[model samples]
Target: MPAPTRALLLIGPLLLFLALVYVLPFLGILRWSVTLPEPGLEQYRAALTDPLVRSVLWRTLRICAIVTVLSVVLAYIVALIWVRGSPVQRLVVELCILIPFWISVLTRAFGWLALLSNRGIVNGWLQATGLTSDPLTMVRNEFGVVVGMVHFLIPFAVFPLASAMRSVDERVLMAARGMGASRARVFWQVFLPMTRAGVIGAALVVFVFALGFFVTPAILGGGRSVMVAELIYLRIFQSPNWGLGAAISVLLMLAVGAMLAALLRQARPGGGS
Candidate 1:
């Protein structure tokens, strides 16, 4: 058999499985989005015009943006230590960063909820101290949502940066040192520029992941900071508006696809970051 034919045969089962599980369901959603609710694009039209939907969309984007920015910045610092630090330091950092991955998302979200809630430990501590008399609301708001998402996403942002950082030449740094360049100068100019692609790639990944976040926002936002994912759930489950929900789902999928495409382009050789 030809190489291409053999290759196709090898992965054909996986392709068929994905088509059955993913493509078919996606097609169903696309069909429902347009044909339901008395047909036409009524559902999509409503999605565009509805103020609540618009607000959720805006808030989702805003929160995702904030999470991506914060995650990348913090992850950069973490990745720097991860790449440049001593072996003991690297092992400790890896343990701290990787622990979250082993926990379920619900567990993590609820943990954040417990920690940040009005009567939670943080607020309790503040009240115990001379900080404030009343408990400050933390969870069930955008702040809590951002905090949760950034925590979840930082590990994601770190590895790509660490990969980029690891690929940096120690000889180049030594040469810079030999030239009497300051530590800050070498890092700011030589090191950072080399890792630009990784930073952009990590940011795109973090942003895209943040866009579809449901559980964390649902738990942390406490319905107060309803993002698109939660809004979709409400429309589908609570309102029983299948058409509207499907339309929103399609739109969200498209937005995610666009971001992923940009990330892919940036990752390709000779592709401009």
Candidate 2:
């Protein structure tokens, strides 16, 4: 068979699987968003105007933004270290970063719960040390949610950055150093600009992942810090408002799609240059 035909044949099964499992179900959701319980825009209007939904959407965006920013900063630092470190140091740091990615999301969230809860490890230690009489509220709040999300997102941020940093020429830094440039100057002027693509890519990845986060926020928020995903769950499963749930889901999908489109446009040659 021709090379192009052979490549398509190899990918055909995966495409079929995606169509069956993803495309069809998503199409169903779009249909239900408008057609269920009578065809109209009532569900969309309600989702847009509902106070609870507005609050949840805002909270989700806020938390995602915080997580994305924190993750990118921390990951950049780690990736910088990884790129500049010795082979042994690189291996150890990479293991530490990748180890968490192997664990299940629910497992990691529960681990945070145990460590951050009122009577959890940190609070217990604080009380035992006579630092405070009462356990401080940590888990089941925005703080806990951000902590979990940042932890989860850091690895994602690191990989892209590490790849980008590896592409940076060390000779450029050597030239700057030989010219009597300060270390900070070399990093700020030469290194950071070279990593812009990685930073943007990592930020986009973390933000998108954070927006769809449900398990971490649900477990950490304790009903008080509901996010968009949890709100969708409640609308669909708890209240049986399928139409509204579908509408919210569609909105979320559209928002994510728009972001991806913008990112793609910027990525094109001379598009954002």
Candidate 3:
């Protein structure tokens, strides 16, 4: 067996599995999006032009943007701390971060519902403390949705950033400091630039994940704050508009593919300085 043939043999099962599970199903979606009712572009045009679909798509983008920014900022701080912390501190922080990842997303969302709802723990505390006369409407809104998404996505943002931070040479920082550079200047000039790739990678990962989120937005946003995923659900299950749903899915796939391509270009060697 030649080296290339042996390598192909090793990867053949995984490739076959991906084709069977991913490629075939995706092709089915593409076919259905166009041909469900009749072979035409009606579904695609409707999805693009429908006011409701446009609103939902915009809302989804807004929520994902908020989640990505919040997750990246918070995760960067945490990752920086984790990188600088002692071994025990690192272990404790890692455990805290990974604990949420181990739990089910549904469980976490529901738990947030209990904590953020009108009569939930937070409101209960506010009222008990005479902080406000009325229970604040927190859950089932944009604020709640952002909170849930940020919590869910922070771990994802953290791991990539931590990997990037770990790759950064401490000696560079020492050299900068020994040259009489201010701490902030050293961080801004030396540290952040070195970690740019990781930051971009983490943001891309979080934004993409946030786009497809269903359970968190559904539970936290209530009915008022519908995202694209929830809209897709309603189109398929509630309204029985499978064609429209598939069309929306197709558009989303295209948008995500374009983003992936752009990011890949930036990630290639000699792509960025």
What's the TM-score of every candidate structure?
Answer: 0.96, 0.95, 0.96
lDDT of 1 by residue, 1-273 (tens): 999999999999999999999999999999999988778999999899999899999999999989999999999999998888999999999997899899988998998888888899999899999798998888989999999999999999998899889888899988988899999999898889989988998999999999999999999998899999999899888998999999999999999999999988998986753
Q: Which residue pairs collide in model 1, if any?
A: none
lDDT of each: 0.92, 0.91, 0.91
Model 3, residue 9: distance off in Å is 1.3
Candidate 2 regions exceeding 4 Å error are 265-272
Single out the weakest 10-residue window by summed lDDT for candidate 2: 264-273
89 in model 3: Cα distance from truth in Å?
A: 2.0
Provide the global lDDT of candidate 3 against the true structure. Answer: 0.91
Give me the displacement of residue 34 in model 3, in angstroms. Answer: 1.0
Model 2 agreement with the true structure over 94-181: per-residue lDDT tens digits: 8989899799999999999999898799999999999999999998899999999999999999988998799898999899999999
Q: What does the lDDT come to for candidate 1?
A: 0.92
